[model samples]
Target: MGSNRTNFRVIGLFLLLISMLLFAGGCNNKNNVLSAKQLTDNTPLTVKVLDVGQGDAILIRGGGQVILIDTGDVPDRDKLVSFLKSEKITTIDKLIITHPHADHLGGFAALVGQFAIKQIIDSGQITTTALFRQYLTAAQKKQIAFTVASEGDQFDLGSGILLRVLAPGKPLLTGTDSDLNNNSIVLRLTFGKFSMLFAGDAEQVEETQILKKYSREMKSTVLKVGHHGSRTSSSLPFLAAVAPEAAVISVGLNNDYHHPHPSILKRYEKQKTTVFRTDLHGTVTIAINGENYTIMREKGENAK
Candidate 1:
């Protein structure tokens, strides 16, 4: 009877160990891509076009990740910080500087100190401004990972969302009127049936290159208008190739540059693409769930 009892105890111990092992294996599968049925109303991707006034700043949140693209001009320093705090964004997974222009990169110094930024993706373009130098120094001091994004790099944002680099391709442009603006890092983000193209202030030269090589790939559900809708960018052919259903322009209101040029607005109208401007519309938020999306503007109505 004593031997039989001991045998039963050993079998119980073995079964307990098996149960523990199975539990651990399930926990380890966290990184697996979400299946279709799993993409219910639980997790939705949110993209916010912050009203930085005369610059670009886009916040993308989904899959438990936060991505920031560009930091508006220097004057937006405090406002940007406040916005982040309001959103409860403590850490930034990725910070992408489309270019070194002041309007696009001015808030970098403040951001480095404000949040725990893990990685920085640059457009591989150089500028000799004081702010640019300070920005680089801060990143170096923090020892954050930095990547000079090339044309074909892809970033997995988990949960079936992907960000693919589409510009700053081989043999970078030269002899252009503004080399810096032309080489801005362009990105295309895809989540299920929805896609958005970020055209970081890219002008005609850059737009021409993209349409020439990847016109077919330019199609997107949303397009962040290039160069704040300046006449210098957003060529008709380029816009036609993109054929976006919606366009968002990040620009200031009645300040120095009269952006979202009238001609450009006409072009978008011709394309039958609804337009949203951060200057007029305090902040534009686009929430996406699978193939459907909802747009909420904090300020003005859709551009007329």
Candidate 2:
């Protein structure tokens, strides 16, 4: 009788352990399945240019799709992910790698693992970095849709918001010292009569090329200052061509680059352009409705 009781107790314990394991596995599976479903569900469109300091990460939402342009540096990945979660963005509809530079694409690998990415738009080819290689490998393994975006490529971002690619036009010049920055993807976003230009670190060389191609149509309401306001970028001729009413520069506070170069700021001042910067004021958001728009700083301070 004693032996039979002991055997029964052991069987009960084993059954309990198996039951607990099954329960835990089921929960994990359910959570993953739910997360996958969330990726496909449509969400309202909104654009947020996160303040990752000296790095760029623009979030565009519309038509139930969330598009992220650049992912900032590697150290800021957790902050970027948290910000997205706070905004209830469970998936990234499109991820645009404006360029291969570390500041632009460093956080990409971390993000790819955390979110469901539907498609990726890059300038075509990799520039050979550990991070870049990791991004490429993950992209391949996940079978994420990839495209080499260039001039004239247009896509909708829900509710009449349209993004048009406007740079890195044909031939894809390589082997030049300025190739990386010059090849940055420039995007023009149009919503009704309000439009903004996001030139991803495109310096004078690329700007001159862009002007030659789209001189008449470069005017915009908001300009995301290129190259972190580097003297090599945002040239006077380019500024005149863009003629943006307001400009935002994403740069780190007291950065080594000494961005928002004095000359560039003076030019903007001369043009009477309203300038806002991330290093000083934090995240800057511009919202457009028809032909009108409003600029809001994270700290609720008036942008200079």
- Most TM-score-accurate candidate: 1
Candidate 2 ranges beyond 4 A from true positions: 1-45, 300-304
Error of 1 at 158 (Å): 0.5
Please give the lDDT score for candidate 2. Answer: 0.82
The Cα error of candidate 1 at residue 183, in Å, is 0.3
Q: After superposition, how far is residue 83 of candidate 2 from its true place, in Å?
A: 0.9
Note the Cα lDDT for every prediction shown.
0.88, 0.82
Query: lDDT per residue, candidate 1, 1-304, as tens digits?
Result: 9999999999999999999998778556532324445444455798899999999999999888999999999999888989999998999999999999999999888898889999999998778999989988999999999999978899999998899998898777889999999999999999988889999999999999988878888898889999999999989899888888889999999968889899999999988888999989988887787666666689877796
Q: Compared with the true structure, what per-residue lDDT tens digits does model 2 show for residues 1-304?
A: 9999999999999999999998888666511222223333242333567888778998876666788999998878887888888878778999999999988998888788889999999987468789888888999999999999988899888688889888898877566557988889999888877788999989888898899989999998789999888999998899999998888888877988898799889889898888888888788766555445556678645444
For candidate 2, list the clashing residue pairs, or say none.
45-61, 45-62, 46-61, 63-158
Q: Candidate 1: give the clashing pairs.
A: none
